[model samples]
Target: MGTTTMLVQCNCFDDVDVHANSVIGWQQTYDQLGAGHAHTTLKHLTAERFQIFRETFDKRIVQIGAAPAGRLCLAMPVCSSEPSVFQGKPLTGESVTVLHGGQEFFVQSPGGIDLLCVAVDIASLETFASREFSSADLCQLSRITRLDLEPAMIHRMRKHLERLIDNALVGEALSEAELEEQVLEFMLVLLDSALEWSVGRSANSTVSTYLVKQSQELALANQDEPPSVLDLCKHLNVSRSTLQRSFLSVTGLRPVEYLRALRLNIARRRLRSTETEQLTVARVASDLGFSHLGHFSGAYRTLFGETPSQTPRAR
Candidate 1:
């Protein structure tokens, strides 16, 4: 595939939208806090090569959903005292963090934060592995958990990417393809040399509790139009059986049942909140993915001990 690239520099948060859009197949949401203006610059070097972004924002939180099932992201902070968290784990500025596609994660950054992030499509990495190393299975990149990259290695990689960006800015179109190849090659080598290998949980040994939590988070994030179970399975890279077991074990309800309850709760909140005064029960129910108003009313009553109509409307 030819390299698809974009370069953006701006002082507004809206301009950062291109970074997420350029990822080929992913969805992201950003919430900025405080009162200061933000500045961002992002560049996509190639379709498979890593994209680089540096931003300075007034305290902000970001939520990312990697819907496309074959990519991995690595992030390292360049300047910031506070660390970012991913899936409940803390990521210090000095170390490298990896996240898999088909998952939901968050990053919290304070004002004046500077971060360096790289995302590589798994297919590209695996293709290189099979042809050059003859160890495609060893790549196990997705299943591997986040690792801490050495400070020296992180600095070197950052500098290298910076140089590439600088070179590209000078209108060096001829070397774009070659630079893409070199970046991917270097990343593969770095992963092999700098990180220890471990076989992650098998399907049987997988903890359904964590999976259930992840599903709930995804569902809540999309409460207005929650995804079907099959969609959830695909985004989570898990089997239907696993998701079922997880939901059952964690919430004492099947996945579908839990989703119904979640929708009902959301509806209740909307009905009670002043912001939704103009919304009717039927409208709220339908908005939350309920097709039949009667069924939705019954489910809502059973779960909340009151019919949707009985819920207090905003005054």
Candidate 2:
């Protein structure tokens, strides 16, 4: 869908999960896996059929989500504290990941990762591709998972994305049609690069991700009364050690720690919602299976750097 004018949104977040949901046109969640107060930023530009965004995570995080349907997402990390893993593949500065519409992806960051991403509607992209490219060429383009690029190429693309974001923020000289045209041109250059470079393909199997996703599904199904690590181990039919390793490998947190942190994150969200009439710290904590207000408050403060009582008012 094309709008007459562009939409620019820039926001900062203290909660990783909140930051995850701020990304325009994506279904994603960010789980904090490192220490310290969470400080994240999301800068987005939406125009016509294409969107561009820059996300910065200051702490270690496990990002689980999918790009919007009917679009192709191209992303590369602007910088990272360590090599971030995307779908089990390490994304170096020279490597770019291509995610097709509605494909679930996992990212594990050591800490401090800045990502630059672009999503273009697939139908519009194909219309442009059909002009000069063969059907087989388009097919190959759709199947690419990653592309290794030279430093100069990465720099060029980064600059283009940053410029678009800047122009959107400042209400710069570019008109709506001009912005759309620039986006289409950028997509063309990106597709051409995808064809020119050696494509990095995924493996036939992703057992680690399967286990993690299964566990997450199980855990979320009972989030109101979140199961313990032991309960999850029993339900998944995996030993405690195996489950622990799986959680640690896929997410940076241990099994028990991930569950607890997730519950805390959800609790924060509930407390922050204005829809929850007559909300209280005690009620929110109790509903999330936190029996002891004192202990819950301690854990909440440790993770979010604020007390539960402050959450509702912060909104």
**Which of the numbered candidates is closest to the native, going by highest TM-score?**
2
Q: Please provide, for model 1 over 1-315, each residue's C-alpha lDDT reduced to its tens digit, 9 standing for 90 to 100.
A: 233664423234444454455444457766555455545544444443445444444445564565345666676676666766655676664567777767676776644456666666667666554432324435555466565666787788878766666656666432444455556655665675444432332334247877877888998888666776656766887645456667877788988788878888888998998444588887887788776677688788899899978888778
Kindly provide the TM-score of model 1 when superposed on the true structure, using C-alpha atoms.
0.51
- Each model's lDDT comes to 0.63, 0.76
lDDT of 2 by residue, 117-142 (tens): 98887886676565435588878887
The TM-scores, one per candidate, come to 0.51, 0.60
Candidate 2: pairs in clash:
none
RMSD, candidate 1, Å: 20.5
Each model's Cα RMSD:
20.5, 22.2
lDDT of 1 at 43: 48
